[model samples]
Target: MSSFDAEALERAAKAARELESSKHVKAAVELSKREQNVKVREYDARKAEASADAEKAKAAQIQIAAEERRKTIAFERKAKEELMSRQQQMERQRMREQDQLSRQREQDMLEAKKQADMERDARRLQMEQQIQEERLEGARRRAEAERANIRARAMAEAEGRILEQRKNEDIHARDIQRRSEAKAAELRGAIQEAFSQLSSTLGSYIKDSTALRNTVFVGTALAVGVYGVREGSRVIGRVVERRLLTPALVRETSRTAGTFGLRQRMKRALGMLPAEEVGLDGIVLEDKLSSRIVETASATTNTRRNGAPFRHMLFYGPPGTGKTMVAKRLARTSGLDYAVMSGGDIGPLGKDGVTELHKLLDWGETSKRGLLLFIDEADAFLSSRSRSAMSEDHRNALNALLYRTGEASRSLMLVLATNRPGDLDAAVTDRVDDAVLFGLPDAAGREALVRVYFEKFVVRAGEDAPRRLMGLLPAARASKIEIGEGFTDEYFAELAARTAGFSGRAISKLMLGVQGAVYGRGEPTLTLEIMEDVVQRKLAEFDERRRLAKTDYTDSASEAVTGTAADAAARRSSA
Candidate 1:
């Protein structure tokens, strides 16, 4: 009913049960009641003591809060006083600064006024001095002007007197010059008259003397005859050198044989001529071969520059292997004049071969630069002397060549080309300084050649193509050749493989065949089939030629064997 705790109620019930079970039940109940009252008193005392401690702590907290508030108020009051004191001090400093600035301004104004007054006084003094100086200068200038006028008048009078005297002297000199000229004219007239009389007397004597007139006529005729012969011989010598010394077998040359016309000169200057004609542009060879050739060319250039004897060379190769082409290029690169001759041409000359050969050598001797004498088919005439087929005239011609080439010549370089190097005379072989071999093209070289020729003949076949047939016509009208999509570098490599045994000239001819085949077609397009047909035809032709050449060689060998047997039988019969 009073909202007592359950624990206290349970403790009362337990005490009542214990008293009911006890014998002294009234006493147990009275003791439990006393214990409960005592415990209640203790609990009240502890609660009162805790309330008193909390009140004391609350009072202590109130006192601490009051102290902190008082300290905050005192600090705020001190800060306010400090701020006022600083503001008052700043006001005093401002006032003092204003007073100092006013004093400085007053001083500056006083100094400025004093400087202005001093400048004004100085200007006044300067003006007075300038005026005094100007007065003195004006007086001095007036005196100088008066004196200058007087002196000018005196000088004018002196110049006038001198001028008059010079004029009189000039007049006297003119009179003397006139007299001298008149005397000189009279003397000249007398001298002319004397010369005229003397000429007339001499003319009359010359007209009367027949012997003297004959002598004069003869002397004049002799002089004219001498001059005519000298001029004629010079002209003939040039004609011989140009026409006769240069042999007919010279298929092409880079030397300036005669004068070039203006148009030709313009074309050369504009680079219209083929680069191969002037340099080593179109030549294709193996690297090692080309290197050796270049070394020889450098040696030749050095030899020529040093004024040393020109070295003779031999180019041994199969037919159409570029020996002749290299010879032409060598002459140009060596800075030497070139003259090409065929050795076979000497045989037909009979007795005149020696004379003609001599003339060629003599013409070579006259070259300011050395002459490169390129003899193609050299073995045709310069064969071994042990052969019985050699004619007397041929032998004599060979002897003449041997004699001329025995010693190194400063004016002549001998370059011999031959397919049959073994057929060449030992004497001719001995004269060679450098020997170059032109082997067949290898696979890579053949590939390169294939590309080069294809570009020239197919890709570039147009009006830009080189002129042919003595340079009188174009090789093609326009680019009518078309390469197929299948025609690539691999195709060209296959083509090179097909043309394994072909020489450079043979390859060129094969391309020419390709061109012709294209032109023969209606559309003039180079299809793969057309190229194959042309290549097959050329290959067949090449095989036929090779077979024919082999047969000919065999027949010649048999004929020689039979002829030898016949000669032996004849000799035995005579014995």
Candidate 2:
């Protein structure tokens, strides 16, 4: 276009060229400006969009923070409500506890007041009692004072009567004395006249030889007579001794002749045979003690002490504890003659007791195999000189016994049995080589005693059958008892334990009682129930006896009086 417009260009070329250049420049500038403006607008749009995004993010963050704060506040509020609810419950509980404490305190105060009232009442009653007692005492004192005054008046009257009686007796004595002196002077004058006549007659007789011959004859006769009298006295002594001391034939009231050795001879005559003698084997002593005793017996038999076959033994215990039985058994076992005497009886005989003791010792010495002298109830007479009532006779008898005991004789093995050995003289105890305590049958001893007694007691086929206590096991097993139950060993043992205080004698008596009951009832067997009844009665009786024995009558009287007084006072107070 420019080429074509060359002619036209000549005319307007400069104008065109300038105009075109200007236009081009303008377009370039415009283009440049548009591009710059577009860039700036895009930058402004991006900035606005970023600013909006920032604003939205800030709004979201604020919402989130507000949500968190709301949740924390809600949680804190819930916790505060819970804390307040717990506090309220605790406050209510505290109030309830305080109310309970208040009630408790009130109850305590009420109880304290109640106890105080009771104590006050008791104190008041005690004070009243004391005051009443004091009043009674004062009345008693007044009565005693009045009685004393009356007694004084009576004593003065009695003294005056005694003095008047003495004066009358003195006057009567003087009158009698004067009369007696006159009689004496008359009697003396008569005696002097008779004596002068006898002297004159004697002088006449002395001048004769016939008188001298008569005197010689009389002297010779008197000497012979004196010799005969002394010889007669010796014969009488021998006869008395043989009859009383040397153990002669003693005629009983039935005229039956029996050897009179000692008082215990009667017992010996009825004692069991030597072969049948009961040893410790059949007894219910402790194994240690029984065995020791059995062993001692055996050993003594095989041994000898100081040339004697055995030594002295003492059996001390309660009565009926088999002491005598043991002693007899010892004698049998030791091959010695058993002789016994009651020291208690000796106490009653006085001087005769000494003679009896000497006789016993002499008799024992004469035994071929030796003798075992058992003095039962020895403490009765052999009590200490200081501890017991002593008289000249008793002392002499005790001395005789001591002398006899002291002389060691191979023939004498003296055994003393006493319930109270402590009461025995020290000298008597000193002679005891061995001492054994026969304590009340323990469980074992009781059991043994029961068996022994039962074994001996023959169980009859019928209660009506003649009752014999010698029933042995053979007889028992031989005849089936028609009774409800025969005695069992176990039952007997138990009965023994139940009969705690029963001695061998008591047990024997109990069995006898049972036998009596059975005999009356006509029962065949000794039933446990029957035995139980018997034991109950026996124990009750035993307790009563013990109480009575220990009770002092004076003390009982005082107690009765006091009790009566107190009861009367109480009755009066109640009225």
Candidate 3:
């Protein structure tokens, strides 16, 4: 065992130790490897879990990204669709605007055409109216020219006719004048022969009783013959000339003519005469006469500063009153030239009437002698427009008369006689300076007038004859007698008393009627029987006229009263 064994043991022991240490190290290593392996396994497990989670997160991210992409695409698509819709709406709006513009243009063109057509129609109508007016004006002008030609022809024809009539009248007048002159010359020769014979007879008578008686007788006879011849010649000359030969003869003729003419003209113009002119003795205007008129005229004349004396008078009265006779007397007393005019002569007063009146007035004014302008029935010219129912022409004539009367400044007298004073206008009355109111004659006036009439008709009887006749008949009966010679103052007085309320005109008519009755009986002188018969007839006529006038007056009064009563009743009712 020794040393070798010890060595081997040691070796073995060492080997054993080594072997144990190897086992321990191997076990430790194995344990350490197991622990490490466990740690690694845990790490691997954690890693694996982490890796799974990471993978999940990545998957979620991918899903989210895809959703975002889808959303973006959807948004882009909507925007594009909206843009297209806007474009379509804009295009529709443009189309509507264009359509409205076209309609407006068409309406404007139609209105312009209508206005042009109306203007053309108006112009055409105006032209037609102008042409019609021109034609009417031309027609009127032609008518006026034709009327002027007709008037000229009528004037020429009228003048020719007037000239022919004048020529005929002139020839007749000249022939009458020549015949008168020849007769006058013959009368002168006869007068001269008679004078020569008278001178010889006177020479033969010279001294001695017997011879003286013979010579005286012869000379006386010769003287008578000469006187007779001269008287005969004058009578013949007057008849030939149709006028009195000398101034004295002419004056006598004029006096006689005036009485007859005045009576007739006055009766015709005024329808009446004064009692004096009719030969009835009565006072038409008692006491006063023409005093008022004379005074008024005198006053007017006195007021005149210069020119000739004014003696014109106008007498206006009712029918049967004296006007013309008074004028004639006035003309005779005043020594004025007298001319008579009838109102009827002025009726045809165109230019001719006016000219004649002017000429007559001028002649009167310019004459050396005082002229009397006597106009009968003056109311015919001076009548009121309302009363006369005058035409415009008549009124114009009256105006002319008024002008001449008012402006007259000459020594001419005018006497205007009228029956109707009421019919004269105020202007006419004012222009006249004097007016005489002539009324019906009273008993005394009528008697005086009758006497005047008797003097002209009956030859005057001797004083003894009138008394003798008065005794033979009753006083009233004898007075009514229409003596051929004019009545005496006493005879007219008795007749005037019997005929009460009789106008001067009626009295004169009665006288004429009495004369007619006497003449019918073939009696030379008027008798009482004739007078009575005539008076009875006239009285009956007068009574009838009065009755009719009274009846008319009564009826008119009744009507007026009834009208007044009815008017009063109506007025009361209205109130």
Local distance difference test values of all predictions, in order? 0.81, 0.69, 0.62
Question: How do the residues 1-575 of candidate 3 rate in per-residue lDDT, one tens digit apiece?
Answer: 53546777888899778867674878877889999999999999999999999999999999999999998899889888888888888888888777778877887886686567667777878887888788888888888888888888888888888888687988878898999999988998888888788767656554346889876899999999999999999988745333212221011111223356666465545434322221212224466765643444345444333454464455765566667666655554444556677665676665556656765665555445456677888787778767646767677767777788763446566777876655667666554555566666778777765665444333232221221232343222222233544334555667778776566777778766765565566554775545556776788787887677542112332233234434543544475
Provide the clash count, candidate 2: 4
Residue 346's lDDT in candidate 1: 92
> Looking at model 2, which ten-residue stretch has the lowest summed lDDT?
248-257
lDDT of 3: 0.62
Quick one: ranking by TM-score, best first? 1, 2, 3
- Candidate 2 lDDT, 203-312, residue by residue in tens: 88888889878988999999999999999999998655643443421111111123644424443444311223646666667676677679877766665433544567
- Candidate 1: lDDT of 407? 73
Per-model TM against the reference: 0.54, 0.47, 0.40
Candidate 2 residue-wise lDDT at 301: 65
- Candidate 1 on 1-575: residue-level lDDT in tens? 67759998999999888768889988866899999999999999999999999999999999999999999999999999999999999999999999999999998997798689879989999999999999999999999999999999999999999999887997889999999999999999999999999999889878778878888899999999999999999999877665434544444444554455355555555555554464557788989989888888899999999998777777876688799888888888888878888888999899989988887777677677788988999999899999999999999999999999877788899998877776777777666766677878888888888888888888778747666554656566775577767788899899999988788999988888888889888877888888887898799889998877742112332233234434543544475
Stronger candidate by lDDT (1 vs 2) = 1
